[model samples]
Target chain A: MANTNASAVKKDKKITWKEIKRQKTLLIISFITVVYGFIFCYWPLTGWIMAFQQYKPKNGLLHSKFVGLDKFKFLFGDDVFIKVIRNTFCMGVLNLVTSTIMAILFAILLNEIRHTLTKKVIQTVSYLPHFLSWIIVTGILHDALSSTGIINDLLLRTKIIDQAINFFAHPNFFWPIVAFANCWKETGWNAIIYLAAITAIDPCLYEAASIDGASRLQKIRYITLPGIKPTIMILLIMNIGNVLNAGFEIQYLLGNGLVQSVSQTIDIYVLKWGISQNDYSLGTAAGIFKSAVSIALILVCNWWAKKTGEERLF
Target chain B: MNTKHIKRSLEDRIISVLIAIFMIVFITVTLYPVINTLAISFNDGIDAVRGGIYLWPRKFTMKNYTTVLAMQNLVTGAKITVARTVIGTFTALFANALLAYVVSRKRFLFKAQLSFFWVITMYVNGGMIPIFMLYKNLHLTGSFWVYIVPGMIGAWNMLVLRTYMLGLPDSLEESAQLDGAGYLTIFWKIISPLCKPVYATVALFVAVGQWNSWFDAMLYNRMKTEYTTLQYELMKLLSSVMQQSGSADTAKNSTAAITPITIRSAATVVTMLPIICLYPFLQRYFVTGLTIGGVKE
Candidate 1:
């Protein structure tokens, strides 16, 4: 961003109408994007005012009763809201931890395979699930974990379980199932970044380590892991900001009456109240809380990254 | 040296065998669900409920696909999904690339300000309820344009395209300028052709997104059947089976031959078919897109 104009800094550069006229095409394009950015991106921000009001759809924003933070007061006071926050946090942490570890591990192990053709096939197959939407992924998950499904058959054949387990029916299983769903869908896709970072590592380090009689595990531990630490830290910090966005689609699609306690996320809560229950004000309040926390988290993480002399996002 | 070499080879061989086993297990786990679903879709719906169908369908039948394809709503959905994927992909690619070009130009004054303005949008959002309300207010609900307009100029896509364009030789643009080409002419005639790889990348991302999306359809166009999407239709079928246990009678009333499990599987298969067909093409472009090396002519 800072260096955009360095090339244009010539002595003959004129700050004149003729100069402006020369850039007419770009200016027009810029104006279109500016208008677009405001309309689609910035304009909805004004509607955040609904969070502070007893917003009625019929009355609209202007005529709606302004409640002065009453909706937030209700939200903070509600036990359901508190539970929803906890669910969002727990599932978020679970997803973050599992997805990160799996991606890095997959990348490292994939790096271990010396066979290029075989490695490419595995990597390509691994990314197959990433293209699938949560609807299909969760549908497949629902099928795979079903009582009459293959999982139950496998367990039954091994006599590991006397009977089938209703995996989705139990609250305890919901979080892990969500995490596994996230891992299945995303781990391979996320590994691409780590793989790129791993490839950028100096291969000579591996050669030198091997010459010193280092084992493969030792080489990976000493060389590959440290090589990708910066990438890990940068990605980890960026993800810290999105901690509230555990997921809506997967939970929404897979969740049922049985697991409702564990499955309701902030997004689902907002959708439930804002649209279904017609409690627009409460929904807006919850949305505000999410946005505020996200922005704050990003800022705090950015500050920490700066202090540690890491690659800061800003 | 020979003793050490022999010892390392023994260890390396053991590890290689272990890694091969692990890769085989990983591959099976990753591809099993998709293959199982495909098998179930081809299996007789009633026999699929008998519960032993593995890689191959025990009782093969095309009835499930036939039933799913026969639905009028699904046909509407498939059409809408195709329209959006094609329309959304082209428009978003052009719009985002154009915006990127506009904001990335060295000579373009206000480039920094415009870039920052869009970049900030990446981190902060107006939240869901407000955006829904805004859309409702703008009369975008129940309209097909809703899919295209709001998502036209993504900041991330714009940034990727901009970085790619910036990597191109400045001499090309300069030489074009000397030949009396305007910015628009250079953008269309010169820059866009050179942008095939990155364009392919963005196109795959946007196309897959538009194709696989169902939430927008559920949220905005649920009541508007004419504007339905294949994924949303599948979601409805999926949730039905989910609501009642997987073997529930959601489809039992229709035919004993087609159970909810096979119908849901078939519907899901239908919904994701386009993306799967295009997956090979997607794989080719996205890896290159994410790894930004300078393009050489």
Candidate 2:
């Protein structure tokens, strides 16, 4: 029995060595990938120290003296930073609500279409905007919302308004415009998920509802929506993590001094302080704050999802 | 039954018509701006300002294109953007695919730990300041590698690929192993080939992201005009032109005549043309890609 135990141990060690030798190529590939991650994704993390230091390019990160939590305190004290946070949150929430609702409605409507060709065409058209970069979308917005743009012409021709409203110049219209652009860009793409989820529902359920004399809306309410509720809940929980992103390119492109008050999101604030102003510490502080908030939100939402017995991201 | 059927039929008809109208209005609202921008791009500079054209060009000219083409930085920017997109996407895919494959294996000893490592990074980043400082310290600033290296493997993309990989039947890998196939051989000969759809989807996502990205350029290549990306150049050009034209009243006798609406529209069209043309072929994959990442079970 002692001899048998020794033999088993010997075989186990030999097998492990054989396995390791056999998977040498995969090990090498994984090693390279890990190294890449370290160099690019992980190494840049060292710069986070700039958040604590009053960073200067000439003095370098190592040579720069640390200011401790002064940058964070400065951020809290800044009125502009406070306003930027509010704007980011407001825009993010607006985008999340409007885009999700529109996508859900669009998906339901698209599914109800009896003709496959028409549905395909609508889906194709809707998803096209998702591919266009914010650069192009902002350009389209700029031209379309200009004083003599198509929107103004249409409104004027229809006698909806006597004069062209300066849509871009107005701060009140900034968040709405951002939301509208997001809806336009994402609704079609976003609807594809819900549509996929809806299709996963058994066709027999729809037939059963029909036999029971349920109207289309009633069937949708009772069956289709409930079928995709888990997907919706999961997506909602996941998106809560991005509630501070609000976007940077679109706002940066569209903003001017006139509408800066409302258009400056957290991302733009990061850019302004971190890149433009060369205040890396302040910028890092803001970024750290944003990251922290995002993590907290995700945790909170995940907890909520768990408590409700819905799917959680983690 | 007759009265109820009639009322129901009428309501259905009304609802359908309302839906059709709403769809048309939404489509038109969304499409018209894009189409109008294209029209203005083709329009003569002077005629575009007169503001009569809506659906079609008036006094057509390609002068705006010529002018943009002649601009010194445009070609350089385009080259940089294209190079970055191609190289960045390749490296990203390679890294992501390798990592994902290893992590996807249930029998792999370090799979769980590696996945946890990636997920934690996703939640808590080093933040921007630290990242910039790291780049500067590493002397990566002003190098084209700055754009490609810093964002090589997206954790989100890795998660999606891992999920898709998990869904594949384990029997395939098991059978291959039984046939004297090693991990790398199975990955190359079996797993990689079967992952065509996911690969194509991720490639498109990464390519488009790299193509559209200007933030890194804005941050790292600020002083390096030679390496400025296409989007950055476009932003710089448009903003400068707009600044010049917008304050024409303040800066009277400034190049107001040169700041034609057609030139701006033309630049916009030109910058967007490559993406728009490439989108239709890629749109099919985009939906699948987004759903795979977004809708976690």
Candidate 3:
């Protein structure tokens, strides 16, 4: 049987080509997948070679004059690059911490509600903003935060401040706005995974805890938190890779000249130089660095996950 | 015992009230901005600039929607967006499912190599410029296929689908194999039906991604009017409105019935209309499918 062959081949852990030849049809079918991976996923990697050269479109990838380490040198030397890195790191961490905490809190609280109808409605409504495009999300943010808009209008009525605070024009408020926008958009969507993990937790654990007179908060603290911890860790590990991403749209959409210093993430920088400025080589250099960091973060997280005896996303 | 029961009931009542309050706040905060945008979009543009529209239109008019819906490019953009979402989602699903099916079968030679090959992609990248250049080189740019071809096999979604397929009993596959079925037959007849939930989830992910994407159109299909997407059109309108605030004309205009604000809001609403309408129906599948995270194994 093919099953026995598969198990036997797997156990042998050697080139049992004769056994595999029996399933040659499957291998031939998968050859397309192999070739597809090279063209799309692996082929672009060859373009990384452009990072080493002063890449020119006219000359193309190969014929472009090679300037060894010059792009990286210029990138690292720029004071603006340092600021970009800082803003990305700061905003990334802020988003990660705030969104994760808010999502976990929402998930736990939603799970506590015994009424199914109310729970379903709230959960359904919570997912609305996540589904909206970032342009739409930022459009809402613009209207809500404009000088004569609701935030300013409310502030005037409540006398929080005598004058309207221009939210986007200021640098200090930019990071918080990005963080809040991210939370507003993603909290409910992210909580779905946590809630799913919670649902997977055995109901018997709860009944046992109840019999032992475990209070509601105690039950959450003892059972629910621990139960969802692996999901939390795995998600965290997965998200760590995206920490550098900081997303191009939200930053690019909400970011303006006034807050450019604070808002230009590495992604935006790549767009500004690579795509817009036509400094493809420098952009590739910056992107290569970003990819390097992302890969390193993922590897380190996987290592830690393995060390902690938790499910690691390799 | 009776005292403890009363105490417990009181605590439950208090917690329930608190949760209700929290949920009310959550719903309001989530819905207010959207509803406010809706109001501004409906209200007369001239009056909206005066700045009191919150939950409802002050001076109701259909002019904003009328003006936006009348744009020829928006219509074209809508066609392209719809085409891409449908075509992109189906192709990506098929391609990813095919590759995932191949690697998921343990009996397939080079299973680990094929899977980890794709999985490694999820962790790293070739950088954007290179990929863009690669697409350009391959003549994928300036065409509709640009949107579909490069993204046909998303590493992340394929990985998730493979993980879901792995959860199915091996016996289902083995029995199908015993019946003289090949890999494709086994995948179509046995595995595909069982993976409906995950497929739904992946489809939603792809569809929404395609629907919401404008950057591709901006990058590859920029010069082509026929290939422009709805999101890109809206983005153009939004950015124009956003950047034009520095000019005095936009601020000085007090008489126009159609202002940039109303136009922008209306276009945004129109762009988002399809996905928002479609998601509610697909919600049942994705919710169940996503219960198993990206990497369940």
Top candidate by DockQ:
3
* Per-model DockQ against the true two-chain complex: 0.58, 0.47, 0.64
Worst 10 residues of 3 chain A by lDDT: A6-15
Give the interface RMSD values of the models in order. 3.1, 3.2, 2.1
Q: TM-scores for all candidates?
A: 0.95, 0.91, 0.95
Model 2: per-residue Cα lDDT over A142-253, one tens digit each: 7777766777887999999999888977899999899999999988888989998998899999898877888877888999999999888888887878888656778888
By DockQ, the candidates rank as: 3, 1, 2
Q: For residues A34-74, what per-residue lDDT tens digits would candidate 3 score against the true structure? A: 78888998998888988999888999887999999999999
Q: Model 1: per-residue lDDT, tens digit, A1-314?
A: 43655544642244678878989888888888889889889988888889988888889889999899898999999988898899998899889999999999889889899789989989988888999998899889888998878888899999999999999889999999999899989888889888988988998998999889998878888999999888888788888888897668888888888889889989999999998898888888899899898899999999997887786775
- TM-score of chain B in each prediction: 0.92, 0.92, 0.92
Over 4 Å off in model 2, which ranges? A1-19, A56-64, B1-8, B248-259
> Distance (Å) between predicted and true CA of A6, model 1?
4.4
lDDT per residue for candidate 2 within B1-297, as digits (tens), equals 664555555656776777787678768876787788788878776556668688799787888888878877878888998999999999889888888999897666556667887877777777666776678878899999998887788888899889889989887998999999888888889999988889889999899888888878888889998899878887776676556546536334434333356776777777777877887777667777877887764
CA RMSD of each candidate after superposition: 3.0, 4.3, 2.5
Per candidate, native contacts kept equal 0.68, 0.52, 0.66
- How do the residues B159-183 of candidate 1 rate in per-residue lDDT, one tens digit apiece? 8898889989887998999999999
Higher-scoring candidate on lDDT, 1 or 2: 1
